[model samples]
Each structure stands twice: as structure tokens, then as C-alpha cells.
Target chain A: MSEFDEGTAVVRRPDEAVDSSVFDTELDKGWQIGGGINGGLLLSLAARSIGEHFAAARGLHPYPVSVSGYYVSASRPGPAELRVETVRAARSHSTGQASLLQADDEGRTLERLRVLAHFGDLARADEDVRTSATPPKLPPVEQCVGTEHAPPEFLASANMLERIDLRLDPAYVGWALGKPSGEGRIQGWFRLADGREPDPLSLLFALDALPPVTFDLGLFGWTPTVELTAHIRALPAPGWLRITHSTRNLAGGYLEEDCEIWDSRDRLVAQSRQLAVVPR
Target chain B: MSEFDEGTAVVRRPDEAVDSSVFDTELDKGWQIGGGINGGLLLSLAARSIGEHFAAARGLHPYPVSVSGYYVSASRPGPAELRVETVRAARSHSTGQASLLQADDEGRTLERLRVLAHFGDLARADEDVRTSATPPKLPPVEQCVGTEHAPPEFLASANMLERIDLRLDPAYVGWALGKPSGEGRIQGWFRLADGREPDPLSLLFALDALPPVTFDLGLFGWTPTVELTAHIRALPAPGWLRITHSTRNLAGGYLEEDCEIWDSRDRLVAQSRQLAVVPR
Candidate 1:
């Protein structure tokens, strides 16, 4: 098998200009919903390209402290071009906008995704404040139910289910059985299918890897994300990442979900908030 | 006082090209923090500009569903140019990037703020989901303690205190007396000093108008925001808006806070999440 056989192909560099690169959406095919790539994977691809640009252009090892992505259009499989524009470069932080585009038959570039990311040094410690929120209680990863062996119903419908190792908390798996918990919360362990070590970029995918928390409230189907913002609190340790997702309000044909990611060490690694359209 | 005396001046249009406009930051003088305008005010200005652009260019009444702002530099109080670029104009939503820039003596514009915002229609209603979160309990606006009459201690140091009418939940006010509740939560009522009706645009300012919830955790001083994202859930009713702010994790010299706004009818209006440098 090729080295880029799995999701790593999403970050494979191209022989293009310094500010641009090409990505293959083949690895992301399994994650597709409603005939389009998952929004989380598209966001991660844009972030990976922007991070590379920050490193090559400004010599900054940028861990995205905050990333806001607007899903302009659905990204299709095949080749896509990522264009990066440096909005501002400072000593400690740099801000940039990256666009994921595809070429039409006439070679006109069409935008599929746009993201704004803020990069900072995660290791730089000045003054630290103790965290007040602790990770939620969950069964060990081994004891949890992995999606790899999900029911034929979900597997037959969602090919993306096989791309990652998602061990959902047993208490919340009722949704898979057509019995939702009636609560907008989910907690579980998540890791990429290819077993790459978790990093800031991977955290982007991890944050959105789970199905919409609204699904537990009997709102099912493809709840596409309108916009998503993720904040990196600390660099994650190498192991299964614990994710706690909850939604406070669902109103006016829209809902917002907030997620907190904790490393195996119980360190808060990242927090994300997203606005999505409620399922019909 | 002229017609542009109050909050209306914050949205003053510039008679320039469709892509650019100018803003007088003098209207923001009262909201200063550490000799510069508060980051929230700057974000609101950017949102206002982008909203206007969406309205003019696409004929859509753009309420910001998601806004991400990176405070690249401290904005000086004066006239600055707000340049808007339409990133993508879709059928129901339009995404845009706006930069707030300050010009030098020679008219070379220097960028001070960069923002990406997703605008959606506030009037469009589709299938709705029930909200699970409730607004915090607080005294009536008439009985609550307004910042207008704050003790000389806080009022003397924070010049921004006088520009907004904030009624703190008395239970959580011990921090003002150097007695912290040991919890990172703050509930309050907010409205403009000039008594403007609270709209989707004004809700942006109200979300960040209060002091950081970290202050309740015994941390103080200017906790500058590195990035902020706010989601507009519903249009607010005309009355004092209820705000509930809380923090989950504060570590590695950074912290994240979440805020929820509710109109007088007890309906959720907007929700915001921000990442800021921890107070030293």
C-alpha cells in the first residue's frame, strides 16, 4: 500500500508554488455524507495547508489557537487546489485565510471551502491558570462500542463509518438503535483510522468526527455545518482523545454545539463551537 | 448631539465604493480598555460592516450566524477604514472577510483587525428544535446593581464601565470586593448607555461587554481576546438582554469563555465563545 493510502493523503503536499498546494479527496471518500466530503475533513485540509504556509513562510510552528471555517460548497473527490493568503504576520501570532478550490472543465477555479486560522506557539508558557472543568466520566476505550463493528443499518448507509475508530460511550449508543437518549450530549474516544499521532491539526477532525449531537434529540439526517470555530487550549498527548459534545440551545431552525477535547492525560487540548442547521 | 450621537454612529456608512468604507473609532472612546477600545467593540464594528455589505450586495438581511475575529493589533481611537471582500455569496448565506485598518500620515492603511463572518437570514424559519438550556436567574433590571452606580473603586479604573448599563447578579458580585465565588460564571443584564434597542448587531457587543468570567475566579486585569466567535440564534426582543457567561478551562496561559444571550421573553438570542490570553 502507498504511504498516503489513508487520511494522511489529505495533507500530502504537491509540487506547486509555496502559497498553493493540491490535495486528493480520495482518502476522504469514506467520510462523505449526502454525496459530499465531511465538513470537518475539509476544514482540517485547509488548516493543514495554512499551517504549512505559516511554517514555511514565517518560520512559525503554528498550532491553531482558533480556526473559523465557512463551508461555501460541498467538496468533491479528486484533485483540489488550496490557496493561502497571509492576512497578518506578527512576532508571536500570525493570521491567514485559506481557500480550498477545484478546477472546472474550463479550468476556472471554484471555491469549495474558506477558513480563517490563528496560529500560535502552544509550548510557550507564561502564566498558567488552573482548569475548572474536568473530563466527563466514560468507560475505558476497550469497554466502549467501536463503530468499526456498527450495525449493518448505519454501515450500509454511511461508508465514512469505517474510516475512523470511534468508540462511543455505551450510554449514548441508543441513537444507533433508533432510540435516542433525548439529550444533546455525546462522549467517546476517537482516533484516526490510519493511527497517526494526534496533533493540533488532527484535533480539527477529532472535534467534528462525531455525528451531530442534535441527533440524540431525535433530529436525525445530515445536519450540515454552516460554520465551525475551534480553539486549541493545549497540545494533546499521544493516545485516545476523549471528546465531550453538548448542545445548549436548538431553536429557529438552527442549533449550536460546543465540544471539549481532553488528551489521555486529562489535559484540556481543544474546545470548539459550531452553528448548524437543524435537520428537517 | 447630532443624529449620529449614539449607537447609530457605530454603523455610519462611508460614501465610498461598495468594497470599502471608513469608520470613526471616536464613537468607541467610552469602551476603552488599557487605553484601547475593547476587543468586543472592534469585533462589533467589523460585523456591522460585513452585514451592511451583505445587505447592499446581495439584498439579504445578514444577521451574523458565525463571526471569528482575530485582534491582530490594538486599534487606536480615530478614523479607520473598513474594507470588505465578498468571499462567497450563496443563495441563503453569504460569507465575507473584512479588515479594519488605520491609515498613517501618508494614507498607507495598516490593518488593525481581521474578521471572517457568516451571514444568514434572521427571518427565515424552518423546522425548529427545542432548546435545553435556560437563562440564569437574576433580579429584575430595576433592582439589580447597574454599573452606572458602581463603587468608585471599579469605576475609577475601568473607563469602559460607563458606556453600558450592566446589572450584575448580586450573588456573583463578591469578586468586585476581592471576594471571589471560586466559580467561573457571571450573569447580568446589558444595554447600551444611550438606550438603543437591542438588535442582532448590538447583541454582539452585549456578549463581550461584561468583564471576563475569569475575574470571578480571582484573576484580574486586561484579559485580551486572541479570537472570538459568536452565533446569532434568534432575534432579541426590545428589553434588557440577559447574559450568562462561563469558563470551562483556563490553562497554558490561555482560557475560553462561553456566553449566552436571552431576550426579555426568555428566548435565546445569541451565543458566543472566545479564546483569550489568561490574565497574568
Candidate 2:
């Protein structure tokens, strides 16, 4: 099994004592970045817990169509628990909220991530009627710079890079050479090293897998995400996913970064927007 | 008081047994569109509830910085109840989840909207260091088409227009003459008719106050928003705000529309993205 699959595995906990369901999972170190767990990985764990709750309840909605997560605190590698409560279940869709919690250094259970998700079956989606969205032009994957070869300082904090293959557009990687592009944009091709196929749940991880767009703007420090919302528009076809992340506005110590992902079939599979603090 | 202020007024409900805080508010007819309460108004109510929750608890974070709301069902103009639960209260920011519930025809309490909001003190924000964002080019307010005089069919359902002044860019309002530019974009100037200025709270309503961007694509039918996430980057200046909504991808019976709000000082105040079903 891929490391991602193993890392995000969750087991339902016996929960007759509480109104909501609880699940336990172990956060692994393979997904750590900047001495903290990847935000996407934490989000995926919350998504998995929600999916498990719906499955055990035999709910008709199985796929996460839209989910918004707020990062309450930094997560570390350890045993964590997720508590999910169903908000509502309608004929067409279901909504739930999940909280990923872990024990801090003081042995206090801290809520690290909180997610509100809407689930539905994507197989029932209508066929595409029109699309003006076109894929961004990029050189062949071979010509692009592999993120595994990123600057040594970046690689020091980006331990998650070892689990996947991310090739960035050459034009946007000038920062790696000590000459930043200052474009506030990053485009890349993403795929798992073990050839694991991307699913709706895993797409949450991929949506935020790339380096921060601020890196290209000459601000090479960490830009922690404050809140992120992802929409799964369609299921993906098996292959490399083309991704682009860009920020248009930076003000009052906050910036909004937008991302779009297209599958191998050239279909828009996912879209996400995140609010992050501008690195000081 | 402005109709908007009157419409979204919320009073704390006395609840001694419940675990969450509940507030009662009336959904006024002045904000109805297409026989449904405006999504922005519903979101504003949720934000207000969160703010009230923080204030009542004496939390330091008084302003909502990031909020994501999922529209569960269409809401009608009437009495609605908002129940807010504190997710996590941190030193820098506090998080809360709220559900806006209303009684259905069968007297069942149906969840209409669910929101997760992050609150912080905006006055403590850092000064703007750099920004690549620019306001969209627009004609003077007088030269633009006032949305109150929109196409009769659109006006029929857009009663909210009477409470706010929305002047659309003439180049994008060709749909009113049966000649849409097919550009899938809408830009406008927005402000309350009473000349009331926008604050961080009211900016939530203004984020989604304009007509659907799909209208410029000649899709005149209603486009129901499935989920919307808005980030309050800064407080707006006391003047007309420039707003633009546009869609880049439309597929699988869904589309993602993005909106940017710029204050009169040309500072980006708010940004939002919504997932909506395409009109059939």
C-alpha cells in the first residue's frame, strides 16, 4: 500500500458513551513539513473520518463534494482522534462536521483541525455542457524541475516531498537558484511515486501538496494556511494531475491563494481557495 | 435603521439546557430573490451569530476573519434560529460552527445553512507590505446600468436590489438586451441605499450581493450556490465598493465563481468563492 493510504488509515472507536462518533488514527512523519504535519494530510484524516461515519451509518452520500476546513493549531505526528457529528441528511446530499484532535506536549487534547463537509455521489453528476476553462500550458514533465531536487534548505523542512513526485514549471523555480521570480504563481505536475491513483478523498491532499505560492514571490518563509475550502467537481481519470496555485491579493497580513487541478483527461477535477498569512 | 440592519437583527434566545448558543432572527422580505432568501443574507446572519457568541463569552476575537457556509436548502423569509457551537478558542483566533434552522411545511426543523467561522481582531493586522492585486477597470458609477432597472424577469426575483445600489459595467450587462457578451463575468459598484458604510460584518453580505455571474453567459435561470467561502481581509473604506464575479470552469452541472471586493481606497477588502449548480 502507498504510504499515504497507510498513514491516513482510521479505525472506528467504540463510542456508546457519546452522541457523536469517534475514530482513532496515528499521524505519521512521512507527511511532515516545516516540523509540523501537512495541512492536507490533517484535512484528509478528517475527510476519512467523515467518510467512515457515513459508511457505518449506511448513508447514501459517500463522496465528499465540498469541504471547508479551519486550521485551529499545528498538528504533530502522534496518535490522534477525530470526532464527527452529522449535521443533516437530505435526499440529495448530507452534511457533517469533524474535528481532529491530538494531545499536546502538556497532555491536553487540542483540536487541530475543524471541517464542515457536504457529501454526494459524483457518478450522478450531469454531463459537461460548456467549459471556457483551459489548461495552463507547460513544458513536458521531463523538462520541468523535480521538486525532489529543490533547494537544500527547502528540502530540510519539506519531508513530504519524498512520498510524491512534483515537477514545477521552470519559469517559476528561479527562487531555487537564489533569483526569485516574484510572480506569486506556481504550476506543477503531481503524481504519487508508487503509482497510486487519485480519488476524491485523496484529491484533498493533492490540492494542497504544492509548495506555497509565496515562495516564488521571494518570501521563502512558511505561509501557514488559515482556512481552506475545496470543491470536488468531478472524479479524476488515472494519470498525472496538472496543478496551478496563485495569489492575487496580499493585504493586512493576509492573502488569498487560488488553485485549480485538471486530470489526465483534461477535465477540471478540483478547485480550492485558501486564506493564508503573508510571511513577515 | 437601514432595512438591512433591521432585516438581519438577531436577539439572543434564552437557553439554559442546550449546549450551544442559539439566537433568533427574522428573515425579511426585502432580501428575497427568486422566492428564496439571499444566500449572503443567510451567511451574514450566521456571522452575526458567531460575533455575538464571542462577545457574550467575552472572547478577545470579535471580528470574523474567515467563514465558509454550505447551503443545505432554500430558505424562505420568516423566523429562523441560529445555533452556534464553539469549536476551539485559541489565543490569536477563535473558531465556531453555526447552523441556521427553520421549520418546513411539515413543521420539521430543517437545516438551511451551516457555517464555520474563524474570528480575530482585525485592528491588530499587520500593515500591507506588497500586493499584486488591482481593481477591475469600470466606468463611472453614473454610466453603469443600475441593477434596479435590470431586465424585468431578473427584477421580478431580485427584490434585494431595492435595498442596495448595484451598478453593473455596461459592457457585461448586454444580457439585458438579449445580447450577452458570453464572457461569463460580472463587475459592479455596490453600496447600501441608505449610504450606510460597510464594515467587516456587512462585508459578508456585500461579498455575494450581485447578480449571478452566469447571467452574463446568457444562463438566466437561477444558479443556486451549494457552498460559499468568504475571507475578510480588511475593513472597507466609507464609499462605493468595486466588485467583480466571474467563472472560469463549468462542468458536471457545477461551476466555481470567484468574487473580489475592493474598497473606495482601492484596497482589497474581501474575497469569496462559491460552488453553484449550473442552470438547466
Candidate 3:
């Protein structure tokens, strides 16, 4: 794993029992867009904390099957506490609600983020059903344009892009070049910059890592997410992950984007849907 | 609006503040599937209560943009109270968390359902970006098969079907006729059985009202939903909502389904994604 990956895997110091797990970590500025931490990075941090707690306490490997997070306040790049509370624990699955809180100097805690997630056993296997959808076809990674080589203005401003390696499908490079495709869609390959094998937790970040598909429709600038839900279908295999983000309608000041992530083996590993606001 | 729509629109008794709103109503037996109230119907009830509260208290017509619900316990058909608590109210949107709780003989309350929803103003409008995806082509409602006319065994046991009108796309009728298509997809048109004009709240029910798409992949029995998120793009235009439900992969004992709802004008009104357990 890269140094950034190691930095993000900060361990949480449990308070007392497994029911409530607490962690304090310094938000890496590298994960910030503008002054606040990227929402997907925060989600990944929360998922990792909760997943570890469940795995340790229940002796069951808790693979995040579904996670929905509502951003209550902007998460700044500083000290933050993630408190995960177990809501329910059943034989087959477990549910947890977590809050990323920022405290004031007076020691009063304020919620910055909230998430509800369900975890199921990742080791469990199932019979494969015939699938009609195929993995998106894209050129080799070397042929795609990496965000690292993006314009100086974008690379300098979008600090979060520096933390992860993202390569855009050649067909979508026009959007980054200020040419609106008029198609609200983006396809790309992504992986942790530190060479960490993609896991369910990483999938959480990957689901929302893409620039809002709305950008391709000629709307740009902070497309704040209202709520995001991701379903992890399978544990991703090692190597880069391919993702396709697309939007169907942009109306009522809100647009919905659906993302599909395919693993190295060309298996569909995760799917996500989110509602986001267009920049004013 | 029809009697059923009126009945479903139970009034909430607020406690003199915008923070909390309460409503008590009997869980309609017609909304039950195998004894538990339908998850989507419960979501609709919560959204209605929260929407009403926000409208009356803040003068904001907070239509649901996104709603994610995690069923904590099986909601039985009986009296229940829905308590909606304001999570945050911003200038452009408001967030609320709600719980459908049941009280035992001793007045001990138990949470049966929990939901987090973001509401955007129905009065707000924005310039539409061009959309590339079109509504699915399906047979007219008159030519399609209705679930009400299903086999006696299915009709007798599936009580929830009686509460809504669902007309299956002709291409998928073979699945209902016992032929597994090996394709996990279903397209249909849906609306309230009572002929109420389809609204944002009703769209919530319509999102999950269909049978689990996993059934088409030869995986049968109860495929209980783990988490469901729906994004309302535009308000429906008072007619049967066209919906297409499809699944990409069924692996790791779980599967993800995506649903798109289009108004009569062929405009996409809402989109939904959910993770559900495949029957063991």
C-alpha cells in the first residue's frame, strides 16, 4: 500500500465496548476539495471503521453490502471523530449507524456526517445467474488520460485528485477539455495511489470518486451530493477498477447518477446511485 | 384523489415545533407482503408526514429528492406511529430522519422502520440538461398483463398486489408463466389502485412495489431488501408511472437492482437502486 493508503487506514481507538467504536484521525488535506474533505473519502473512512469493529466483535467478516450517507455539514481537513453505533445484529446480517463528528474547543460535539450501512458475510458464495449487462469496453489504461496529467488549473485546485490515480476513458476526455459531450456520463479506471488492493471499503470511495456526471452536461463546480447509496456485490479482485457514471435526468435542481464498478476479473463488484445538486 | 389515497394521507399531529412531527395510523393490511407491511409503502408514509411538516412549518414545499430506508423489524399490519425528526434544514433543502414505531400493550415502543430522506422544493425548477437515455418501450397498459389476474395461488398470497395496479411489459410475461428468462429484468407500469394521481410520495411505493427482479434469474422465494435509495428527479404528470427494474449481478448472496420511473410524458421522474438478499 502507498503512504497515502497507510495514512487513511488509521486505527480507531475503541471507547469501551464494541457497540460504540470511536476513532480520531487527522483529515488529510490531500483528500480535500476546496477546504472540506471529499465526501467519498470520509465515507470510506467510516466504512473501514465500522467494518473492522463488526469483524472483530462478531467473528463474522462484515462486508458492506449497502451504505447510505447524508452529509449534514462540511467536513473540514482536521481532527474528526467517527463514532459507529451498532443498530442491529442478526444471524445473517448486521446494521450500523455512524456519525463523523467535529468537536468545538468547548468539547461539544457536532455532527458532520451520518451514515447507515448493512454488512453481510463476504465469504458466502452464490450460484451465478445469467447477466445481460456486460462490463464497459474501454481502451488499455495506458491509452486513457490520467487526471494526474490534467491541466495545471484543475490539478492544482482539486487536491483530492492527487490522492487517487484516475484515468478517464478516451471518449470522455473531451469533457475535461472544456468540451461538453452533452451526454451526462463518464467512464474510467481508478485505484488507490498507494497500490492498496481494492476492498469493499475502497469501493465506497470509488463509487463517489468520479466528478459528478453532471459536469459532462455543461454544468460544473461543486456538485454537492445530498445522499449516496452503494451496493457492494462482490469483493473486488486485485488491480484497477473500472467505473461508469451516468445520469438519466437533470431536473428540479437535482440530478441522479448511477455508477457501476467492475473489478479486475471483469466481474461487477459494486453499484451505486446518488442524488446531487447542480452548482448554482 | 380516491378514498384510498385520502386514507393513506393520514394527518400528523405536531407538538408545536418543527423538530418533531408525529402521526398515528393503522397499517393497511392490503399493503402487506407475507404479513409484513411493504417497505416502500412505509417509506411513502414517512415521506408524506415529513413533507407535510416541512411545508407547514417552514413554508417550504419539501418534495422528496432522495429517501433511504433500512427496515429494522417486520412492520405488522396494525396501529403504528411515525415520528419524523428534523436532522438539518438548509436554505435549499431539508433533511429528516423518521421511524415507524409500534407500541406493545405496555406502551413500550419498538422501532419497526427507519428512514433518512432529503427534500427539495417542488416549486423549484431549473433549466433541463439534455438527456441521452430514453424511457423503455413497452406494450400499452391495455395490452399488458396485470398482476391482479395472476394465478390463484400468487394472487391469494400476495396481498400487496391488491393495493396497486401493475401491468407487466409483454417481454417479461414468460417469467410469470414459469419460464425463467435467465435475464433479471422487468418493465411495467404502476399506480395506486384507488386511482389517485401519482405524486412524489406515491413514487416511493412504486419504486419498490414490483416483485424482486431476482426472481427472473431463477432465484425464487423472498428476496428481502437490505437497503433502498430512490431519487425523485421530477414530479409525475398524473398518470401511470412507467418503471423498469433490472439487476446486473447476483453474487455473494446478495444482488443489486436498479429501477427507473418515467412519467406519461416519457420524462424520467425518479430512479432507484437497492440491495436485496437472494433467498438461501
Candidate 4:
């Protein structure tokens, strides 16, 4: 199995309460982007737990239609607990909240991340309507620059690069070469290195997998994501997914990054927006 | 005080529990869009409750930096209760959850909307960094078409038109005139009809004040928002706010609308994205 599959896998535990369920997972090494596990991976764990919780209970809504998550604190590699609370399980859709927690040095349960997601059946969803939507234009994976071209120091901590194959459009990565582009845009292709097909759950990771768009504008340092929201538009077919990230406003020490992802079939599969602070 | 000030105003009550505070507000008439109250106005109530909760408890963070909300059920003009829970209180920032509830016919509290928001002091935010960001070019409000031209039928249920002054870019509203633009873009200027100055709280309404972008695609019917997320970039500088709403992806019975709001000074004040289902 791919390292990502193992890393994000969660083991369901007995119910903590009538409306809440608990899941345990190890925050394995090699996913660190800075000093903490990748925000996308943490989100995926939450999504997985929610998916499992609903599958076992209702078996009606299996796909996550929309999810919003807030990063409370940095989580390190260790055993973590994700407590899933069933907020509302309606006939059409279900809404749930998942809080990823870990023990601090003092043995206090620290909240790492909290997420609220809505689940529905995509197969029962309306088909693509005729509209102006189109896949992002990008050079094929072979023509795009791989992480091997990233600064060695950056690649050192971005161990996620080892698990997920990411390729960037040459135009948006001038900062990596010591010359910043100032465009505040990044385009790339992503896929699990071991070839595990992308699914709705993993699309959460893919939506946030790209290097912070600020990197293209020449900013460095950790820009912790304050809040990230993702909408899964459709299920993905196999193969690489094209992604484009752009930032139009950076003010008040905060920046918003918008990402659009399209599957190999040229279908717009997912969209995400994240609020992150610009490094001071 | 303007209707907006009164409409969004929340009166804080004693704590419902230790970590939870309750606020009461009348949904008020003149804000119904389709069959329920405007989503933006409902979100404003949630933001207001969070603001008041933190101010009374810790006076540390007064502005909502980011907020994500799920519309559980439709709410009408009536008395509603917003329960605010302190999620985490940190030195730098705070997170809170607010659930807007209204009693059903059976007297059970029905969850109408729930939101998670991050609060921080915007005054301490970093100065605007140099980047490729600018406001949308819009004709002066006077030259744009106002709600007077909307089909009388739409303007009937859209009493929100009476409360919010919305001026649309003519090119994007052909559908209103029965031409159907098919561009899926809507640009306009927004301000309260009573001339209430815009603030961080009102910006939440401004971010979602315009007609759904799907209207430009010639589709009609209530497109319920499954999820909406907004980021308050900077406090507004009063006057009319230039707003642009666009949708590039509409598939699987759902559409994603992206909105960007700029203050009268052309400063991007807030941005939002919402996922809504296209009418069947």
C-alpha cells in the first residue's frame, strides 16, 4: 500500500457518546511540510472518519459534498484521536463535525484541527450542466518541472514531496530559482507516487497539496493555514489531477489562496479556498 | 439606525451554560429572498454573536478573520436564538461556533444554521504587501441598473431588494430581462438601503448580497447554499462596495460561486465561495 494510504488510515473505536464516535490513527513521519503534519493529511483523516461513521450508521450519504475545517494548533507525529460528532443526519444529507485531538506534554487533550462536513450521494447528483467551466491548461507532467528542481533546503522539510508526485508549471516557480515571479499563482499536477487512485477523500489533500501560492511571489517561512474549506464537485477518474492556485489579495497579515482541480477526464472535480497568514 | 443595523443586531442574554452564550434576534421582514431569509443576513447574525461573545469574555479579538457556515434548514422572519460556544481562546487568536436555531411547530429547537469563525484584532494585521491584486473595474453605481428593473415576480419574494441597494452590471443580468447571458458572471455595487456604513460585520452580508451567479446562466429556482465560507480581508471604508460574483464550475447538480468584494477605496475587503445545488 502507498505510504499515504497507510498514513491517513484510521481505526474506528467504540462510540464515545450516543452522537459521537472515536477513531485512532498514527501521525506517521514523512508528511511534515514544516514542523507539523500536512494540513491536507489531517483533513483527510477527518474526512475518512466522517465517511466511515456515516457508512456504518446510515449507508445513505457516502460522499462528502462540502467541508470546512479550522486549524487550532500544530500537531506532531504521534498517536492522534479524531472524535466525530453527528450534528444532523437528515434524509437528504448529513452534517457532522470532527475534531482531531492529541495529548500535550502535560497529558491534556489538545485540539489539533476541527472540521465540519456535509455528506451526500454524488451518484444521485445532477450531471454536469453546460456551462463555461473548463479544466486548467497545463503542460503534461513530463514537460512540467518536478520537485527535484525545488531548493534542496525546501525539499528537506517538504517530505510530502516524497509521497506525492507534484509538478509545477515553469512560469510560477521563479522563486525557487532565486528570482520571484510576483504573479502570486502556482499551477501543477498531482498524484500519489505509488499510484493509488485519487478519491473524493484524498481530493481534500490534493486541494491543499500545492506549495503555498506565496512561494511564487517570493515569500518564505511557514504561513499556517487559519481555515481551509473544500467542495468536492465530482468523483475523480484515475490518473494525474491538474491544479491551479492563485492569490489575489494579501492584506492585514492574512492571504487567501484559491485552488481549482480537474481530473484526468478534464472534469472540474473539486474546489477549495484557504485563509492563511502571510509570514511575518 | 438603519434596518440593517436593527436586522443584524443581536441582544446578548445570560449564559445558557458555562462555555455557551445565547443571543436573541428577530429575523424581521423585508429580508426574504426565495422562501426564507437571506443567507448573508443569517450569517451576519452568527458573526455578530461570536463578536459579542469574545468581547464580553476576553476583549482580545474583536474581528472575524474567517468564517464557515452550513445552512441546515430554512429560517423565516421570527424570533431566533443563536448559541455561541467558545471553541478555543489563544493569545493570538480565538475560535468559536455559533448555531442559529428557531423553534419548530412542536417547540423543538430546529437548527437553521451553524458557523465556525476565527477572531483576531485586524489593527495588528500586517500592512498590505506588494502583490498582483486589484479591484474589479465597475461603472459608477448611478450608471448601473438597480432592482427597479428586476421582474416584478422576482422582486416580490426578494424583499431583500428593499433592504439592500444592489446595482448590477447590465451585461450579466440578461436572464432577468429574459435574454439569459450564459456568461455565469455577476458584478454589482452593494450598500444598505438606509445608508448604514459598512463594517467588518456587514461585510459578511456584502460578500453574499448579489444575485446568485447562476442567474446569469439563465437558470432559475432556489439554489440552496449547502456551504458558504468567507474571509474578511480588511474592514471596509464605507461608501458603496464593488462586488463581483463568478461561477466557473457547475456540475453534478451543484455549482460553486466565487465572490470578491472591494471597498469604495478599491481595497479588497472580503471574499467568499459558496456551493449550491442547481435546481433540478
Which candidate should be chosen as best, given TM-score against the real structure? 4
Question: For residues B1-280, could you state the per-residue lDDT of candidate 2 as single tens digits?
Answer: 8777787789987765333688999898889988699999888889989888877776579888999999988999889999998887778888888999999889999889989999988988888647788899999999998875456887888878888988999999888888888888999899998888998878899888898988888888889898999999887789999999999877778888888899999988888999998888
Best by DockQ: 2
Model 2: DockQ against the native? 0.73
Model 4 chain B: lowest-lDDT 10 consecutive positions: B147-156
Off by over 4 Å in 4: A16-18, B16-18
Per-residue C-alpha lDDT of model 1 across residues A119-210, encoded as one tens digit per residue: 88887855465767888899988889876544454456566666677888988877777788888888898887667778887788788878
Candidate 4 residue-wise lDDT, B150-185, digit = tens: 666667789888888889888777887788778889
Clashing pairs in 1: A30-A160
Choose 1 or 2, whichever is better by TM-score: 2
Candidate 3 lDDT by residue in tens digits, B148-227: 54445546667888768899987876666778577788888888877888888888888988877866776667777888
Residues A1-280, candidate 3: write the lDDT tens digits: 5644554575678456968787777787788775478887888888877887787668574788788999878877778888887877888788888878887678787777788888877767575554666899989998888866444544666778866888898787666677868778888989887787888888888898877687677666677888888888778899999999998777767777889999999888888877777767
Model 1's CAPRI class? Answer: medium
lDDT of 4 at A39: 96
- Each model's lDDT: 0.76, 0.87, 0.79, 0.87
